[model samples]
Every structure is written in C-alpha cells, then in structure tokens.
Target: MSRGNRWARSLILLVILPHLCIEIYCSKPDPFAAKKKRMSEKVRQMFYHGYDNYMMHAFPHDELKPLTKTFTNSLSELGNLKLEHLSEKYNGSALTLIESLSSLAILGNHTEFEKGVLWLSENLTFDVDARVNLFECNIRVLGGLVSAHILATDSTNRLTKGTYKSQLLNLATELGERFLPAFNTPTGLPYAWINLKYGVMENETTETSTSGCGSLILEMGALSRLTGDPRFEFAALRALRKLWSMRSSLNLLGTILDVETGEWIEYSSGIGAGVDSFYEYVLKAHLLFGREEMWRMFQLAYIAVQKYFRYGTWYHDSDMRTGRATYWQLTSLQAFWPGLQVLVGDVTAANSSHREFYHVWQKFGLLPERYLLDHQMVHPTERYYPLRPELSESTFYLYQATKDPWYLEVGEAIVDSLNLHTRVEGGFASVRDVTTMELEDHQHSFFLSETCKYLFLLYDDSFLVNKNYVFTTEGHPLPILHSWHERLPEAYIPSNWTSIKGEEPKRASAMSMQICPASMHNCIHGNVQLESVCHIPDARDDHRCLSDEDCGVDSTSCRRRLCSMAGYCGQWRYH
Candidate 1:
C-alpha cells in the first residue's frame, strides 16, 4: 500500500469513528420531550393551586355532613380504643381499616394510632366468608396485613415496634395458606373468582379474564417475604409463568383465556382495566424479587407492547399471533401506563402519554372511564371518573424523574379538579360526570389509599423519597424501605418523598373469602383448595382393537385439559 492511500484511510476512519461515538453516547432532543416538560409544569402548577383550594374551600372546616361526621367520628373513635381481641368489630372491622390506621399514622395522631393497633390485635381473623370471593378476600386480608406491617415498622407511625408483629406474622401465614386454592388449576392460572368457604367448583369452567388472573402478585409476593414462606411467592410465580407461556408466538397475551385449556377465549387486548395489571405485575415482581427471569420476561413483554400497541397518543392491543393492531383509543385504566413507563426509564414516552391523558382530564374536569377508538369521543354511558389517581400517579413519577415543576403543576390541576367536582360534604365522592363536572356521592376506600396518596406525593414526595416505596398493583404503597439513610447524600433528598399518614394495622376479622362448590370430577376449580380431576377422555385408547373413529377422539380437548391441570402444559394443538 502507498503512504498517501494509508493517510486517506486513517483520516476517513478518524472522522467517522468520532461521529459514531457521539451518536452512540449522546441522545438527541426527543421531539416529545419539550412538550412533556411543558405539560408537566402546567400540571404541577395546577396541583399546587388546587391543593390550596382544597385546603381552603373544599376541605371540611367542621363536621357538617353525615359522611364527614362519620369519617371524623371514626377517626376519633379509632384513636381511643384499647386493642386486645383478634376480632374487634368497629375499630378494625371494615376492609378500609388499614387506610384509616394509615391516615391517622401519617397525621402523627398517636391516639388514633394506638386505637388502630388495639382494634387490629383484637379483631384479626383469617377466616374467609362463605360468599366472599377470592380476589376480594386476598386484597382485604393480605393487603391489610402488608399495609399494617409497613405502619408497624415505620418510625414515624405512633404504633410501637412489634406491637402487632406476632399477629401480623400469623395473619401473613393464614393469608398465604388461603391463596393455595387459586393455584389449584391445571394451567396454574387462578380462576376469575372463587368462593372462600366451599372450596373450588367442580365441572366449573376454566375461564378467566386478565384482571382475574393477572392481579395476584403484589399481595401474595409480599406475604412470601413477611412470612418466610416460598409457597405464596411460588403460587404467584406459577400464575405468571402460566400466563406468559400462553402468549402467542408474537409474544402478546390476549384479553381472556380458558384457565383449564389455556386457550384464547378472547382475542382482543387493550392496555385497560381487564389487562393492565399483567404488565404492572411483571415489572413489579422483578423489582420485589430481584429475579433476572422476571426482568427478561418484562423486557420482552414491554418491548412487544410498545412496538405493536403504541400509537402517537394511545395504546391498543394488536393480534396476539400477528402483531396487528386491534383496538385504538383511551381507556380509564390506561391511565397507569405512563407510570409504568416511568418505572422502566422511558421518561420521555411517559411524559407524552400523561400529557395526552391530562388533556382528556382538562376537557372534562375528570377523565371519563373510557373513550371511543376512531372518533376521540368519550364513551357517553361510561363518562364517570372513578376518582382514580392512575394519571396523577404517573404525573407524580414524571415529576420525581425530571424535577420539572410541570409535574407539580399537573398535581395542582388534579387537586383543583377533585376539589371542584368531587368534594362533597363527605370525605370525597366516588365518581363524577366528566361532561357536567358533577360530583357523585359515593366514596371508595382507595380515594385515601391511592388517589389522595398520589396527590400528596406530588406536592411533597418527602415521605416517598425518604424511603424506597414500592406501590402495589392497586397503586397502594407497600413495604416502605429506609435505604436512603445509607446511600443518599445528606444535602439532597429525592423529591419523590412526601410524608402521608402511615398505613394502619388491618383488622383480622375484616378479611373475607368467597365460598365455592366442590366437584368430584377431574376439573380445576376456582377456589384454591379443590383438588384437580381429569375427567376428559384420554387420547390413548384403552380399547386398542377399535376403528379409526374410536381412536380419533379429539386430541385438542385432551391436550388442553392436560395443560390446564399442570398450569404450563407446553404447546397446544389449536386446530
């Protein structure tokens, strides 16, 4: 080679290499980044102003209405009780007892805190109701236990350390034991609902929607940690694995399935209510368990969701097999997507998605529960906002990630909307008409556990940042970890921390389980306790010397049944 040729090649390599390095190391301005930032700031400002409004105009200065009186009286009464039995009816009787305890704890109300403990200690029971369903049972009991555990451990909470430790441990054990029935299915996927008392239903259909099967991990997984029982976590993991295994070759899961056969009962999918928590559980399971496999599965599933479902402003499920778009529009449950995105380091996308949803909120003081796909019109009949904080939850995440004042502004806006439309004489109304901005009188427990909590976090975040708070599937904060005390520099507190009331001890008797029927046949039942039976005829002929018709008993049923019993029965012959 000649010297001049060598010099030219070197010059070319030098220029190209440097340019490549710059491209690799530096990210370009995401066209959506600026928009997200501006929108977030606007939201934060709105939240601040709204919070002021709530404090001044909306919040009850005195107990005037029945609901207000009930709430105030409940709090005051809860503070004075002496906790003793494991079954106190009033102080720790309702499913909302944990939230009540938490609220008081957050306020540093020692009287309420002590009463809550007394109530929980005396009333805690692990019995499931004959009519109670499985999912509700788990949420009330396991959710209560976990929330109470957080309060017991929190230094700020007035409850003494180990005050409810033994009872909590026992509660964890019992709750873990109760979850076994849900995993008794052939496919290892839980039934949509189960009866607590009668065990599982025999001859019962093995059908379940995504929400029914996909929302178990948080409570069960937490139980596993608290009780040192792997079975609870294992059951949740098996459900996850079973569901994942049923995904189409394109790596997409459908909306519903026959739990027994693992067949696609409903092909349509959306990032909404019935299916939203499946994605949430994947990421959160990994976070809690530190399992690499969970992370890998989440990465694959998340990438597929983003690649196939995402349009400019919304996400819809595509065909599980072909990756073709099936639905397009906003869902009330889609409000949580942005928060999930923020968790996975896609702050830019999270910001954009949140802004679009915020626009929906602005158009209506609160976002409607659902929207149309092609028209961008709100679903008229479904126009009530359930007072959910999913969008606000995402806004809080965006704010924490960017430190942009916009998130605070969004918070202020949400606070304003709630105060303006939802604040009744009661604590907060359950739902509101997006069109009329009229308040609905019902108030759900989550208003305090999730919605108000997020709003509080957006404004303050001191509580959240001070401890590593992991939110449950229901958007309830759990297992607050004080890791920051060791790792974070003294001068900088993560803006995500905002102090709210500590979670209160769950009343034992408040927990309820559903009662389902028992079957003799070899079918997987809904409730966890029933043993599986294989009633489907075997593919292999016991009577060997038969004609083709006798031998040709459909293999599909046999295969499906086999798979259903085992949870993950490998592949299926659908045709």
Candidate 2:
C-alpha cells in the first residue's frame, strides 16, 4: 500500500507543480502595454476633438478662438506681439488646416488628410495683403506645407494619380519665391517680417531673431530638393552660413540681430524661443541634407552651449560674447532642449533636464512661459502657458531612444493635464496664466500639430517603424531620406527595440556618448553599471601620466579615472 500510494502521489505532485509555475509566470497582463494602448486611444480622441472643433468654427481662419466658438486671423498677428499692422482686409490661409495635414497622416487618417490637402491646394493662397513674421511663417506655414506635400506624395500614401499634380509643391514654391525677397538685404539674413503679396514691406523691422534667419534651412532646403530649384536652398543656406559666420568666439549667437547691418542687436541669448531652433536646425540639417558643414557647426555650438549655458541640467541666458550668465530663468520653450539633445545621443543629460522640466510642470499643472530661477517664482509678466508641445516632443524622443516606461508615464501626465484643464467645447484653450489656471480664447495650431502628435507618438509609434525622421521645430516631420543623408548617422538607424538597451552602441566619444562633464547634470541616472566609466572632471589639474596608477575614481558617479593618452592620465576611459 505504501509503494503504490507514494508513486501515485509523486506523479500527481509533479504535474500540479509545473501547471502552477506556468500560471504564476503569466499572471499579470503587462501594465505598460495596457497603459500604452489606453493612453494612445485617449490621445487619438483628444486630437479629433480639437480637429473637429477647428473645422466646425475656424476652418478657414488662422486659429480658433475656442472660448468664443469663433476664429482669429492670427497669422499676421503671430509675432506681432503688439498686434500692430494687422490688415483689416486680411483673410486666413486656412492656417489650422495646413498645420493639421501632416498630423492627420501620422494618425493614419489618409482620407481626411487627403480631403484637407485638396482643399488647401484649390483654395488657400499666400497672396493676402498681410505682413507676417518671416520666421513664424517659415516654420509654421512653409514647414507645414512642405511636410504635408511629402506625406501626400509618399510611396506608402494614397493620392490617386492625376488627382495630385504636385499642387502643394507649386503653392510652396510660390510662397518660397515670396520669401526670397526678404533675403535680398545688404546682409543675406532675411528681414524679420515680410508682406506676402508685395514682398518685404516698406520700413519692415530690420531686427530678427537668430532663429528667424537661421532655422529656414530645413523647410527651404527640402523645398529645393523637391522642386530641383536651388534658389530656395541657396537662400536659406546663405542666411545660415552668414549667421554662423557671425557667431562669437564662443560659438554663440545673440537673441536678436539686424538683417540689414549683419550686426547683433540684443546680445543676451539663451536656448529658448529667440535662439532655440538655431541649435535644433543645424543638427537636423546635417541629417537631412548630409552637409558636413552643418554637422561641424552643430557640434561646436553644442559643446559651447553645454559648457556655458548649462548649469546642472538647466540652461540660462548668457552674454554671447562673454559667456557670463545673464538671465537666470526657465522658459517653457527650453523644454525642447532635452528632446533636441536626444537626437544626438546625449540621453543622460537629456533625461536629467527633462525631469527638471517635468517637475516644474507638475508644480504648475502646466509649464508657464517663464520662471525666474533666481526668485524661484513665475515671471510676473510672462506668466501665460501657451499650449506648447516641447515637453511632449522630448518625451516622445526619449521614449524612442530608451524605451523607458517612465517617459510614457510623463506623456500620460501631460495628456491628463490637457484634458482636465484646457479642453473646451470649442477646442483646447491656452492658459492665460498658470497661477490661476485662467484660460484664453486662442487655440494655437501647434496644439494640434506638435502637442497632440507627440503625445500620441509616445504611446503608439507604429508610423515610425522602418523609418527615421527629424521633426522641424514646429513639430512637422520630414523623413530622413537615405539619398539626402551621406552615410547615415548611427543614431538614425532603426533600432531593434525589443530590449531597452537596443543595439550595441557605437564607438564612445564625449559628444557621441553620454559621458557628461561631472561638474553638473547627473551623467547617468539609475545606471549603477555605467557609474564605473562615467567620470569627466570639471577641470584638468594633473600633468601627463603614462600609467593607470596616476588616476583615481570620481566621487559623484563612482567613476574610475585612468591614465592612457596625452602623455597624461586618460586612465579610466568613461566612453
């Protein structure tokens, strides 16, 4: 009885044990997957809500006045902060519709995207007698049109033959031709404002932001590539090259410049609104046009920005000539720095900066336009929170680069914040002031183009599969074509993202890898293994050492410094 009973019990126990193990391993449905799907749908609905409302009330206007269920011809009014010189006869260029074109394609609404494309091609014109900010017009209207054109004619897209005759390209070319006059200054740098119908307006302001003249290369260059007319690209490149030549010895450019004189006007500058895209564009221009010159410019400029403006992951305005900190403040636009950094493989610094921006966002339920870091309070006058997409844009890039669940969580927080505070029956409204959560009537076109697009991409990036893109400052995506690139940057290669670490990293260098200067900005957060090789000192105090014995470990990142190169200590190589 003992032998038979024992044999039966042992067999039964083995069978049950294996079944129990399988159950335990597969018990929980993946939380991240669920959240990703749920957040993706939420974002999709958010897009349609705003999109439908804009169509309903503001279809042919520049922007929706959501609070009034009306529209604003905000194009000429965009950078005209004083609302000066707005034409009484001005009509909208279907600004919101153009902005939504590429976004609709990204969201996989080809039918609706096609509809908007046809409408624009047939109806919209830049011929209105309106004075517009050259920079804003280029990034928003020109960027939007060029991007949507590419998407419209993409091999993967649907635009039945003959139905599309490169009409958008024609419109873009006409608009681009108009932009050429602004570049006819004594200096190649374009005027800050131009009249669409008559060209550069009489006595138009000679002053322009560095970004105004510097950021046109992408859209204009792409227009050249598509049109086979070098005028557009040549004009943009002339301006950019001229602007670069104007950089201070520190590789810095000021916030404002005089196009006619080729002289800097306002020398205090930061990587915020006035000068932000100048940095973003150079690197992306290299990627898109395969220009080695752009790559070199971007590399030197980035190092200078890191060395001077960056303080423990935060960047402040500095005298371009002196490299002395000028304005110790954070503008919401600075949130784009992390995302820009991600494109060039500066993830560690990017992560650290992104977290700081998110912390501020959490504090206000939105990022105010300006926060004076010295006083630790919002700027008294610049207290509004426009529906900016920078934080979400960076969040998307970080998630793509790292596959971290945390970025998805950040996107979730952003989506929830928009829904809770900004959503209105008309559309999403801007925060007039973060302190009171008071709302404004205007709905920015980027609220649809960048903010919603990035959050949606963060949660669902199927469109990015098998393709690489560099987003314009306004959040319009232009594919990084193989022909456009020389030898592709390793960063542009599609990663096998089944694992978090992705493909084996390229040969490490201070700029190519994340070995940040240890003086500030955590070199690698949550990277216990990385800590061993991440030391880069704030200063060089020692002479050449031929052996590893000369150098020691770093305290902050738990690094091991070594001696190898320079007839000096290169001991523990961080990269």
In order, the Cα lDDT scores of the candidates are: 0.55, 0.77
Find the candidate with the highest lDDT and give its number.
2
lDDT of 1: 0.55
lDDT tens readout by residue for model 1, 1-575 = 22211222222211101111112212445444555455435434433332333334322221112233342212212112342121222222244545444544443445645655666677665463332335545654467667666667666644755455456657667656755886787778887544443456556446777766767777877776666566776677667777887887767888878877888878778678667888887766655554445555676676667556765446766777877777666887798887776565444456667877988888777889887767888887888886787987887766654545566667778877777776655446646568876655445445555676666556544444334456775555565333211211222322433321232442211001111011011122343332111111222221221212111112114222223332322334321
* Candidate 2 segments whose C-alpha is farther than 4 A from its true place: 1-31, 159-162, 486-575
Runs of candidate 1 with Cα error greater than 4 angstroms are 1-93, 100-111, 126-130, 154-158, 201-205, 438-441, 480-575
Q: 127-152 in candidate 2: lDDT tens per residue?
A: 88999998898989999999988888
What local lDDT score does residue 288 receive in model 2, on the 0 to 100 scale? 80
